[model samples]
Target: MTPYEDKTIKDSLREERKKLKDMNGKDKLWYIWEYYKIPIISVFVSLFLIISIASAIYSNRFETALNCVILNSQFTSESTSPDDYFDKGFRQYINLPEDTKIEVNHSMSLSFEESAMNDFTYAELAKLSAMITSKELDVMIGRKDSIDHFGKMDGFTDLKEILSPEEYEKVKDKIYFVTSDETGQKVAAGILIDEADFEKKTGLLIDGPILSVMINSTHKDTAHDLIRYMFGL
Candidate 1:
């Protein structure tokens, strides 16, 4: 049979469909794959490239002003959105730009006790380590043991360095000290939030929460402002 030399897309589709209609299941599948594989693969590749570019743009669109993680807390985003109070209020308080973003993550939960450690706890710990290493973490709010664990690793910035003399004096009584494993010297690693109206201000409730700034945080001034804002210093 002589094939049409100038077949249009519609004509080709029609011819292919007619051929497929006469074939059995395996033969039809093979024929379609042999003929249509390139187009199918092209469509998927285009979609993947579009998605990758879009994701890159979306992720870089907003500048993160502050990133705070609340660990081992009973707080849930479902119960109270951080946008309603923490993020909104802080942006307003600091007079940040509209495009700036604040993150208040309370989903992480960890326990140091061997019996309490599980896969989820390990995963959260790994995530926390990565965040610290990347300097994505600004502030960490956790209990004494949790703070101590990171403190021993020298993960937190010294309060004296980040805080002014007057600011340090104000919170000196509430400072949480930890013996650094490297230096074997006591360092002011965290601030005890016992006296602060933390729950009232941030809409988060956790007993004996300690606030510590990451050693490599890029937003130290903002982190300092946050500490003073929370402690009312």
Candidate 2:
């Protein structure tokens, strides 16, 4: 048998150490790299993968109950984060469990004006469409132009279908209707918010903000509740 094939792990290690001990510094480095590069690289790769998986698992440990998007709105103060105000308020309002999570995404911005359309605007629009298609988006709050843009695309659920009679009656006057592109009929696509009141409550500044529920929301009931919560109804 060949010497390599006959050597045990210990014997091979000993022989390697003897060779390394006899070598110059540069030669030892080259020899080690030549002999152990694959194992060394494999170890690092395995560690990286393990850490990545662990981080992902830790981040996703909590169940996501609601996902709301607030487009084109900025916080009143630099220190005011979504988690500190809006998310916390909604969690308290609904008495959500500690283990459950609520996501309020306010970073995305889009403009409906042809003159304002750019790469960023198109990217945000694509992201919004993708979220709706995946049923990951529940509620949307934005200005009339933004709401109208999505409403015309059939992005929002008709309020009449989801809200109870009493609930409908309460916000009937505040409803924002849009023409459905497919049905060629007016649908209650959004609810107009009292921007001043909303600003006071959430510390977010938006002009003529309107709230709408996504058509394919997995959490329709929570989205309905969010409307009432936002309006303080």
Best prediction by lDDT: 2
Scored against the true structure, residue 94 in model 1 reaches a CA lDDT of 85
Instruction: Tell me how far candidate 2 lies from the true structure as C-alpha RMSD in angstroms.
Output: 3.6
Best candidate (score: TM-score) = 1
Evaluate residue 126 in candidate 1 and report its C-alpha lDDT on the 0 to 100 scale.
95
Residues 56-99, candidate 1, lDDT per residue (tens digit)? Answer: 89879999989999987664335455566667777888898888
Superpose all Cα atoms of candidate 1 onto the true structure and report the RMSD in Å to 1 decimal.
3.3
TM-score of predicted structure 1? 0.84
The clash count for each model shown is 0, 0
Model 1 clashing residue pairs (backbone): none
lDDT of each: 0.86, 0.87
Candidate 2 structure quality by residue, lDDT tens digits, 123-169: 99999888988888999999999888889989999999988898899
Residue 195 of candidate 1: its Cα lDDT? Answer: 24
